[model samples]
Target: MALLDTLHRWAGGFVGLVLALLGLTGAILVHRDAWIMLPHAGDAQIQSTHVLAATTERLMSNPETRPQSVTFANANLGLDRLDFGKGAGAYTEQAGTIVSQWQTQWARPELWLFDLHHHLLSGDTGETIIGIAGVAGLFFVITGTILWWRTRKTFAFRPLPKRLSRPAIVRHHRDLGIVAAPLLVLSLLTGATLVFRPISAVFLGPGAPATIDTALQAPKGPKVALADHLDWRRMIVTARARFPDAELRSLSLPRKESGLVTIRMKRPQEWLPNGRTTLWFAADDGRLIGARDAASLSNVVAAYNILYPLHAAKVGGLGYRLVMTLSGLTLGLLGTLSVWSFWFKRPRPVKVRRGVRP
Candidate 1:
């Protein structure tokens, strides 16, 4: 019992700030589509696949700013996204004119918060640290629940403690931590697994491949110049013909001279809104060169895919978003209060009956 108490306090005290930051950032990200507020160009009336393809191809024609990828605007959102490079993205109308630039966190709070949450402002190294923090968060949750079990009879849900005293705060921390343990564990475990993908194999099964790395290389064909007009309509038609049941989602144009055009799609049965299935086309002639179907994924890989949407609450619309939001808030509050209780608050000494004793 003492060991559990010491472990919980030390872990919470050391990583509480990071966990709180992650929770706060995650809460903000849950409503990203609503808050970013990228100006919509009014919905396009024409919804032809060919027109959509043409719009994207036209956008890539610009030599000064070649896009790395282009995400089509949702009918409701009214603008597509053009990613020029890392940390550089712009919203555009169906015609592909710039509506807004969201390369920096200051300009786009959601994107900045997203990078901070996922990458910790330090790229892969930071992600590894955040991943470790997530594991630590899981530890806290498990240990906290065990500790709370000892005083389960006294559990009471309260918005805040009855008083500003140390004892009052401790009670709030204990009760709230216990209440939020399950959710915190889920969020932390999922988020951590995403960062450290290798951890996924443990749950997936021993020896399961944790990643699938595919790249588009230069094919044996006449090299196409950037100025050469691309048959945009043909590419879309080819992709549809190949995957009739899949919904077209986004397209990534090759950044390098030998790069291939990659398309992302969502099948009907997929839980992820963006879809994991991908197809690559030769940039020179729009020939289908490579493909990965969601339906054909292995059990381990398929199981791993579910974790992302689950952690992000991307499946159940607004209701699930609210649940995730509450979970995040609970974690932030629990971590903050626990840290305060452990480090800052001092135990109050009992008053003596001075009138009789001295």
Candidate 2:
């Protein structure tokens, strides 16, 4: 028991700051759609297939201004985003009018904040560190709950420490941790599982990872570069005809040696902000190579798809956003104070006089 308590304290001290930053950033990111203010940004989402196809065709036909990827607008935010890689991007309206553009991610707070929360601004290395922190955070929550069992009777509810002293902070930390344990578990588990896929086996059972990977992997196509003026309209029309109820979510060009143009769509029933329903088209002629319906995914894979929406508060509307906001704020408080109590509030050794008695 004592060893568990010590481990929890030390682990929290080590990763508390990182967790705090993630929590604060995550809280801010949950309301991203509401905060990105622009002309027609709040306009109603266009549902017409003709309009969508026309707009996509117009934007992609221009090679000089074409982007590597396009994330179309949804019901919440009505401006499509174009990614030109290496931090350059722009936002456009449904009618294919560019509303804003930036040469670097730093030009937009949303882009950088997202990068920070997901990658800590250090790319893949930062993402690995975040995954490690999430694992440590999960340990803290579980062990902290067990340690709290001893003093459960003395539990008192306080959102913040009554004073900045060590005893007060320790008491507040213990009680607050218990209060937020469930939410912390949810957030930390989902985040860690996302970065470290093997962890999913615990919840999803063995073979789940392989099943998900095989199910979502894109099909191989002929080795041919994307056409200079590919039939974007034809591709959109084909995808719409197949998934009549799905909304077009994103379009991504082939990467590296792959010659497949991928189109992602969101069905009304899907929880993922960008649904897993996908279509792969031959880049050379824009012919449909294959399509995958999100609904037909294996039960295990379908269950795994819900993790992102749960973690990001994407499905439950404003109420869930507020719930996750509270979770983030609670985690922030717990992490910040845990670090403070562990390092700054430690007891100081007493000084002895030059001529000590005895």
Candidate 3:
């Protein structure tokens, strides 16, 4: 009991602030479409690859730039994104006209928030720290629930106390922790699994991970025409014929001569918007070289795939999004209050009787 109590405080105190920040940022990110404002605004339609091919050729033909990837717009955001090398990109309309020049990820608020949430703007080290915090979050959820059981009889739930007294703060922490325990655990588990990708292989299988470039290879033959010159229309047509019912999610243009143009699609019954069903084409002639269907995925891999949509709330629509938002807010508040109660807030002073006591 003593060890658990000590660990509970330690986890919430040492890493509480970081966890809270993540939670708040995560809540904001869930509604990323609403917050981000793309400079180019147009009703460009992309029912076929003909329009995309024309647009892609125009961008690739530019001597000053090279196409790296082209992400098609979904229902939420109606702006096609074309990324060249680092710090270079552009947004285009369906008609293939440039709406705005690409800005650095930092310049885009959504991307900025994204970097902060995922890496704390500190790269690999930050990601590791965030992963650790996820583990700590799980610890808090488990230990808090266990400790709550002892005080279950006196439990009184409240959003917050009217006073800043120690008892009131503790009450709020205990009650809120209990209320948000289940959701918090689920979120932390999924997030941790993502951070430590190897965990998927441990529980699922080696093929369960969504790692890209499994089939990538060095260019063997003589160089062909630039990737932009390839028949993108045919590539799209082939992809559609291959997975007739799948919806095109995004496309990754070849970055190098040997690189493949990878297409990710969301098929029916898949939870993720960018379903794991994937196809790779040769950059030269748009020849089909690699392919993987979500339906044919191994049971372990398929089970592992569920974590992404579950953690990100990609499929449950608005209702699930709202639930995730609430989860984040509760996590943020719980962490913030726990820290305050431990370090900043002082214990209530004991009352003294009149001089008769002395």
Candidate 4:
């Protein structure tokens, strides 16, 4: 009880409010990718490698925008995301019209939201403030647990008050806080991982994590002339023949002489945003070179990979995603209720008799 009160007191009014706001936003954003990935946007088949090559040629050869990067999207409404060096390009899955992109400092709405979540969308200051907020959240959760522990004997999840005389806001605050404490803790802890990555890296051994990043970012080895190409259809055929069970999510064409054509395939039973099998091809000759097994990643890298998808519930499918989203919202609500309870429902000081009380 002392710890809970102390933690609550230490949380202050404004900081707690901010954390709650962040949690609320994060809860909303948590399942966005899953929702966005659904068929709501528009239909465009994930183009074949040859077809993609031809499209690239056509788009580039067209009098308009030049191709910058091709982002292969998975599923329907998941037309490949093509980036042009110029700010104006097109999202084929989203109406096939040329769109000029804008973000806080990045180039997309998603990035803007992400920046808002982590950095309060203010760049470095937002990042630092949010990082501090996460650390504070961890503190509050631990202290709250310690306090909640002392009162376990009387703990009950009574969200609605039976008494008609009780104030509604205070009741709402207390009950909501009681029910959502666990979820708030979870949302905070998972989010903190992004800021404090080194906490888990200690277990991954020396230099192994850096190695994994390098491997995942392996270069497109030795680019050949774009004039003669295998094209998208054949490329897809070749990749399918090579890895039968893999789902093609992305394909990055080589940009330079040393570039390699990279095919990223989805992994089985994984929750984070990672593909177990990454097949690299000599961009010029379609030669298969090095492959990365996601299952075999160093503990540090694997841990990092699992965090985002788990945070967003993407790796866990619909049910898991729902659970995560609800958890975040619950936490936010709980945090808000907690502060309200403390602010409005604290016990009144004892009254003294008129004169001879001393």
Q: How well does candidate 2 score on lDDT at residue 169?
A: 96
State residue 301's C-alpha deviation in candidate 2, in Å.
0.5
- Order of the predicted models by lDDT, top scorer first: 2, 1, 3, 4
**Candidate 1 Cα errors over 4 Å, as ranges:** 41-47, 102-105, 210-229, 255-258, 346-358
Which candidate tops lDDT? 2
Cα lDDT of candidate 3 equals 0.75
- Give the per-residue lDDT of model 4 (tens digit) for 1-358: 6656765665744477677778777877765554444233445555454554455444444434434555555542355566554333345543233333432235565555666787786767887777677778767666655655655675556555444332554355444555666766566666666666544444456664565556567744555654344444455566666665666665665555655666676666445543656777775566676777666776567766766666665655667667777776665765675566567665688888889565
Residue-level lDDT tens digits of model 3 in 1-358: 9999888886787788988998988888888865556554434445565665565566555545755777776666677777765657777775556777755876667676878888998889999999989988988888889999999998888887657876788888988889989899878888988898765665566655544223222234324444446767677778888988887777776655555778888788788767888888876777888777888865665666788788877768889989999988888988888888878885667788888673
Query: Candidate 2 lDDT, tens digit per residue, 1-358?
Result: 9899889888889899999999999999999999999998999999688998999998899878799999999989999999999999999999989999999999999999999999999999999999999999999988998999999999999999999999999999999999999999999999999999888899999988888889888898888998898999998999999999998999999998789999999998889999999999998999999999999998889889999999999988999999999999998988999899889998898888889963
Q: Global lDDT of each model?
A: 0.76, 0.93, 0.75, 0.59
Which lDDT tens digits does candidate 1 get at residues 29-94? 887877646555466433466777678668765657767787776533567877777678888877
lDDT of 4 at 8: 61
C-alpha TM-score for every candidate: 0.87, 0.97, 0.85, 0.68
lDDT for model 2: 0.93
The positional error of residue 24 in candidate 4, measured at the CA in angstroms, is 1.6
In angstroms, the error of model 1 at 110 is: 1.4
